[model samples]
Target: MTQRTIKVGMLMAKESPDLISLVGYQTSASAVLIGLDRINAENLLPNINFTFTWYFDECQPYKTAGYLTKLILIDKVDVVFGPTCPEWKARKISGGIVL
Candidate 1:
């Protein structure tokens, strides 16, 4: 079997002075990690491995675009998972219709 590694990029806020927001970010990150762990543990994709790189964009549109560009071009990620707040900008950056 040919082994392949899929690269994933995640855009999320990792630091916040506000306690509530910090907890939320931690929760979101934890959820993604847990899901990935489950998939890997179950051999969901045989002979495939998953790896991820994450960026803290603070949920800003401009930052999302910039970080996404880096993730795609520099990081060479096969998939991107976030930038939850500026949904429209992310869609546009990824060549998706905002409407």
Candidate 2:
């Protein structure tokens, strides 16, 4: 196995101070960090160092799409995990075609 740097894009609601006061559910970013640590500690990646680029969607389709575009074009990430909206998923699987 060769050494590789795999980049992953993440989209989530980064709670602002006011937003945190309104709705606090604790974002999943920390979980991803824990998972990454486990993978590295267990040597599960075979000389791979996973990196992540984060974007805040603020639970909006428009913003999610923009973030997705940036992640796809600018970051050139290997994988993206976020924009959980059904519409976002549809666009991804439907080849970005409009109905």
Q: Per-residue alpha-carbon lDDT of model 2 for 2-87, expressed as tens digits?
A: 78999998776655554433322254666777888898788887888888888776666777777888887789888878664546
Could you estimate the TM-score for every candidate? 0.75, 0.74
Clash number by candidate, in order: 0, 0
Candidate 2 structure lDDT: 0.69
Top candidate when judged by lDDT against the true structure: 1
Model 2 scores a TM of 0.74
- Residue range with the least summed lDDT across 10 consecutive positions in model 2: 18-27
Backbone-clash count (model 1): 0
